[model samples]
Target: MHSRIGLFLSPVHETGQDPHLAVRRNLDLVEHADRLNFDEAWFGEHHTLGWGLVGAPETMIAAASQRTGQIKLAHGVVPLSGHHPFHVASRAVHLDHLSRGRYILGVGPGVPFDAKMFGLAPDVQRRRLDEALPTVLELVNGDSRITQKTDWYELQDAKLQLPRFNPHGIEVAMATSGTSSSSPRLVGKYGLSMTSFALPFALMTPGAPDHIGLAQQWKYAEESADEHGRTLRREDWRIALPVHVAETRAEAFADVREGYDRWLFEYFGKAAGREVISPDTPRERALEARVEAGGALVGSVEDVVQGIRRMQEATGGFGSLLVYVADWTSYEKTNRSLELLARYVSPQITGSAARPQEAVDWAVASRAAGR
Candidate 1:
């Protein structure tokens, strides 16, 4: 398993606090992550929600590029269905140039709420994504004139005027959940990296077999590689999650529980249209459920290290592990979490405090097997 730690710039609101403060705090956190020797720092893009402050990740990446050196800037996802392909490609290219090839473009079609906010119909979104992906790839690869005649969009000799920092291309990754969709296959087809969070619901449906959803994704990658007569390098796959670490498991759980209840269950749940209860569904309950279901990672330094190792083994050894350190919590607590993970958890997983690539072969071969 190739291991690296990352922080999620997910914002949480507290009473009497300015929501935009979250954005500023996240920038500070990124600087800290860089100093702490983290491999990447990610920012999420969302609209009409307090869950994330960044609505335009390209602009955020540009700002972040100037603030730090060495630490890679990632857009947890740029909603592909919400923006024009040419515009997205142009912005990313500019950031890559500005950062000197330190940008990781993570993109997805986005959630239902995102589509609704952008007034995109389902059919239009599907068609746009299919057409836009190829166009974006071409643009990133230095193709200036991309003409596409599609149902959702039409382009006539559209091209990017920016100079390419990477002629071969910088790293491109697809953001996904645990769904047996063609999206994962598309990632393999393009030989792009894959990054996903835990969506236990998808794997726990009434008729869903245990880990079936995960297996489906693995299968898709494998089959897509086979169909293309090539395998995706293992180093191109990643799994991201919200992680909290402390000196002891009890302390770690205690510190994060209140924040999880407030930010995750109360704040995010309400925003996501789920019921929130204080006592009946306490923060601990929510945390325990997700932990058992393989969603969030919370524990002492040793426990977190063990959890990471288990996940690495389960995925047949993945390449990258993105850890989210920001979410409705105090600056001190969040910083402490980042420090603990960086000091203790990261070294154990990466084995040398750098990126790991040993799992690349297995990832490629597994994707070729379609599972």
Candidate 2:
């Protein structure tokens, strides 16, 4: 099977831009991805940061499901720690039917800031997720009554009222940053897929790029899967990172420098309480560092191809590459970048296969139906 290329939209618009317009632009992006024949799109949920303003990714996914077809839709994640598993299962079933089995359930422990805002501590969120996830899985895939009582929530004799559209049941993925995270083991134990967030940062060790560190993470996942008598295939592994492909290296760097730097320092750095000033070093060297450690992709198509090959070599091989969404320049430029990736970068990695004609027909009819 060919490696898949996909998009992960945190939907981080320029701060203070009208929120309504930002959402419209995001919708436009998903539509464009569909037309470009991208494999999937993962929408994110965040409560606090303007950079990640979408609080209910399901609302967005439901809307996008109408406008496009063929691309799989994921929550990127739903913060299960704060939600009732019964409700999450119901919604997941409804969405699966609505999307005609195109939905992938991605669940994560709530973000620290969002969890605090909801009046829960970090450890509390972890505990909640542990209780909620299995309950959700049982509710979605099993017919038996599920009664569970936890300190934070309770589900008593809960069963999904709606039948799943996909007879095989929904696929699940957990987000994790590294091997040490309990998330890998937990997901592995359940035969769920794993999403490695921030591929560049995860590959880092002591201020340098370390592919060995990346392999070690995969090793942990493999071992965890084995211990639980579950199989985790390398092709089920997805690694996501920021990527922007322009006509030239200089052009790509210029397109992303300002917005990327602001995101690095203000959104991430401030959240972590550190100063991540852009280096006074030469532009090329600094840009290389950004790719190696910062997880930002800024270059031509050839550059992106080389980067993916390097990543594949590091991980031994994985299923998919998800491009992190960034409209640092403009929406038009962002759309153009996707076109470039689909046209040049993806074919280079996965081979040039024509977009299936049935997919094209399905998208056309779905767009015409407006649902």
Candidate 3:
């Protein structure tokens, strides 16, 4: 099968933009992606950061599900560490039925800042995830009611009222941090899919863009699965990264200038406190570093294609490349990037389309020879 190309709408807004308008535009992006025949549209959940307007990812995803007919709608993540899994499963089932099985449930331990808002300690999130996830699985896919108790939550014969939309059950993906092995172990134990961390800076550490853990994550996942008498499939994995495509390298650079600046200056430099990109550093130099590291994609179609290839190599092999959504440029430019990815990046990046090259050559030769 061809690579699955998807959009992960974190829904970053321009400074001083209205939340209502930002949300509308983000939902509009889902429709645009659907029209382009993109494979999926995943929404993220974040409560902090003035710029991240997607407070409830499910709310937006539920709406997007109606607006989009073909593209799959996912949670990108529900931050299971802070939520009671029953509620998460219940809402997921609701969306599943509404979307008619087009829903994908993505769960994670969440970021430090957001978890802090919920009054959760950073180290305990993963432990809480470990306690809650198995019960969630039983509730979502199990035939009978489940009774489970933990320090953070207690489920007493809890069960979802709605029947699962897809008899096969909702497609589930566990989002992973580059440093954390909890996601892989949990996903492996349950035989579920995996979503690489959402952005370059946040993927590995607090705000570093090293992206040095894909191979290690999968290795740990397989080992965990083997320990559990299960197996992990490469096709069930997806890596999320920031991507913007344009006709030329310079144009692509220009398109992402504001977005990158905010990500580096406003988000990472000030709030995230990692100084991933120094204020004194040149914009082009920072962009080049991120691109060359396979952490972000901002360039021509070929450049984005190679970025994906670099990530694929890093992971050994995987299923999809989720374009972590951002509004670094105008709506027109952002939409154009998706169109370019669909029209050009989609076919060439996977090399699946390249398999038919010989046949095309024969047809061309036959036409030229008047045969």
Candidate 4:
């Protein structure tokens, strides 16, 4: 029942803001996470999306590595379809060394906007992801003189110039989405971990009897691993959710209402050609829709703890819960929320072993007091 707490930053900021400030703010948050003893922080990569301003997660990872210690730095996901495998392998290996073995190489197909930016169609992007992943794996695993050619890229005797700092080698994770995904199978085939994104919420809605459960994602990974004669560990699974905690539900709702609405209705709805809900919508009604969409986790600390518990049950279990970073009412409130999460939520979820004894003592004390 104990799950490690981490942060997942798409580095989503309002368009037109200074991109330099956005990165500085994100790095500050990463430093904060390290001080709070957060297990990891994943930085996202996007090219065309104005909201996701980080074009290269490795660069940010390298900078953040110098600012903090102990916490692991993840690529969040680098789109393999757009980059040369040799480049990806070399940069990942170099970053692993820079972080001193605290780096995770997460791969995924490029997003639609990024694909278009690179003059690739969706189908081509997926094919590139499938074909290029294994080659990157081989190069990072110390393969030399690799002579492989794909429709997208070619390698002739390609190999990493630097050895991995970790003896076990840099950890590799593939990003997957929806209830079922080919990414899980691919991750399993390579004996790598899986990071669930846009999942546990991809198509969720209120009172919808059936939605993609977190357990289903794990199931696909397990099945794929079984087929490949490899055993996938549940602890290797990481799930991301947008969570906001405060002193009260009302305060939490108020803190997130503006930013959440802008993200849901304005950015996503308009971008996807969906109808946008009115900004003047009632908070309660907005809350319902947000819950349905699996966007914000707005509540008090106890509520967030219970929400995570429900997710754990739904997933059967997972190794980590990564909080998705987005704009809040103010930067100060955002930092406070992270502080409360680490101070309050982390202990509750990770300290389950001592709960039984504490509960027994409380009951016994109540009986003795004749309450």
Candidate 5:
């Protein structure tokens, strides 16, 4: 399993906060992450939720691409139901070309509130996604004429003016949960990668199980491949998590406590209409609950590493482990956490070559000289 770490661009609300400052801070993290040799930096989209400032991921990624080199930019998820197929295809293709093919287009039918924010009826989201996905796929694949008529949308002979630069185009991924039937089936049918949260609601629900969620998704992918008479490749599976790492278990928990709790409350509690609390639960129990129910990784470096290894063994080794590093935390701490993971944790898992001795020696010498 290739274990590359990616940072989710989490917007932070601070005391005396300016909205634009969050964007600047997030961009700063992207630049720092790129410099630290992180594989990818993902930007998420939301509307009416002060939780995130990047309502348009394409525009944000365009800015990020110019600011950094060698780090892939991903729209963690763009709500497919909110836009016309032509627009989504055109914009995604443009970002792909702009980033020189360093773009991963993640598409999903987002939360019901997001649909409501866009003046769209939540009931029609499935129909919209079903209608839009195929058309967008066809258009992005360089089709000049696409004619489709559906209950939610209709397109006739839609052709893209900008020539498709990426022959493979952007890799498509679906963000799904355990109980979502359409998303898993769509992922299989389209041969797209799958990324779903081990989220609270999905895990704690009576009918849904954590491992069962992953198993069902893989089952669909396998069936889809069998129907097409091809072996399913490893790169098609990704597991995303909220992770933090430090030298010791106590230090890791302490470092992440405030920010992690805030994130849980904001994202899971408030966003999902669940009861909010001060989170008196112990860190281990909280993490276990998330892991068993939703899939959060919060522990010491060794604990995190072991958990990832277990996940690989359990899931038959997925191709990617997308980590969330950004939240309501200091930029320096976030960078340090990423550096520790890259130096100590990822090397053992991914077999990436170690940093050269000369660079390490120079850093030590520079620090000694300064002292």
Candidate 6:
């Protein structure tokens, strides 16, 4: 099956950038992706951080649906641990209606730091995820009255007053990063489409083959599926990672240099506590460390194509590639990076680039034959 090309906008704007524009640019990029024929764009929700400030992904998706023609829009994730399951279900179905079936619901156990501000214990999130998903899914699937009680939330015969836009039901994807997720069994129990984010240490170790446990993720899901007598389709499985491409490797690397340092210090360092390369390090050395991390696809368009191919094999194949939006480059250049992917990388991966090149080759061959 042909793979989808989508964007995952955690919407990582740096400290100095205007919050309004950061959010606006995310929509603009969605519009741009729509115009470019990209498959989908997923938005993140976060209230605590100065960066990634699009607090309500449903709102972003609703706004984006108006600007876009057909590109699929999704909540990159709604933090299940932090909100009532009914609220999640209602908003999800609402967005599904607003997008005319273009919306997908991706849910997770909430980011660790974001959970901190809500005063939710780290372990509570894991438990809440397992508890909340069933209720949320039940509500979204149809107006089935549910009665359930958990330490975090309670629902008594609750159902959606508003009917779901799609009778078939909304697509709910489970966002799992590394082993942080405690609900793979539940994931398979429900047969939710799996959306895997790049693990923080994915490429940190040399010779760390096996796609950062991509295959393992599916293995656990399939095992749990058998236990529940249901099959989770790999066609819905998605892997997301960082990407930035330009006309050349040098240009691509250069494009991300300025804001890259700040994003490291501010977002990754302060916010995430996962900064691999410090801004305090010597400039050249800091850059060298980044190049060594091997996490991002900061190279020519062709490089991205090849890198994704390797990832595809390592993951054993996936339905879509959602480019994790890290705005560590100029807005114009970031837009260009995506354009290059649409124009070059996509066709190359699908083997369509060769046909176009072959047509040109045929024209050149005739000229060489003195036609």
After aligning candidate 1 to the native by TM-score, how far in Å is the CA of 157 from where it should be? 1.9
Among the numbered candidates, top TM-score falls to 3
Q: Show the colliding residue pairs in model 3.
A: none
lDDT of 5 by residue, 1-371 (tens): 23377777633354346778877878888888788777787777877555666788788899999999888888878788988888888898899888888888888887676788777785688778877887888888755699887765677888888876678767888887656577877887877778765543432342233555676667777787677665666666777666777778777767766776666566656755665332444534554455444366666778888877877776677766777654735667667788877777887678654556567888999999995
lDDT measured at residue 292 in model 1 versus the true structure, 0 to 100: 57
Report the number of clashing residue pairs per model: 8, 0, 0, 0, 2, 0
Misplaced by over 4 Å in model 6 are: 1-3, 202-210, 275-294, 354-371
Lowest lDDT 10-residue stretch of candidate 1? 202-211
Tens digits of per-residue lDDT, candidate 2, 115-165, equal 888998888888888888889999988788998887777777778889999
Return the TM-score for candidate 1, rounded to 2 decimals: 0.86
* Model 4 ranges with Cα > 4 A deviation: 1-3, 198-204, 209-211, 272-284, 292-295, 352-371
Query: What are the per-residue Cα lDDT tens digits for candidate 1 across 215-286?
Result: 467668878878887678766677777788878888878887777777665555676665433344444477
- Each model's lDDT comes to 0.71, 0.80, 0.80, 0.80, 0.72, 0.79
RMSD of candidate 6 to the truth, in angstroms, is: 3.2
Query: Cα miss at 304, model 1 (Å)?
Result: 0.4
Clashing pairs for predicted structure model 4, backbone only: none
- The residue-by-residue lDDT of candidate 4 on 156-261, one tens digit each, is 7777778889988889998887665688888778889888864235322543312245567677778888899998887898888788889998899888888876
State candidate 2's TM-score.
Answer: 0.89
Candidate 2 global lDDT? 0.80
Q: Write the per-residue lDDT of candidate 6 for residues 25-59, one digit (tens) a residue.
A: 88888999898888889898887768878887888
* Worst lDDT 10-window in candidate 5: 200-209
**TM-scores for every candidate against the unseen true structure:** 0.86, 0.89, 0.92, 0.90, 0.85, 0.89
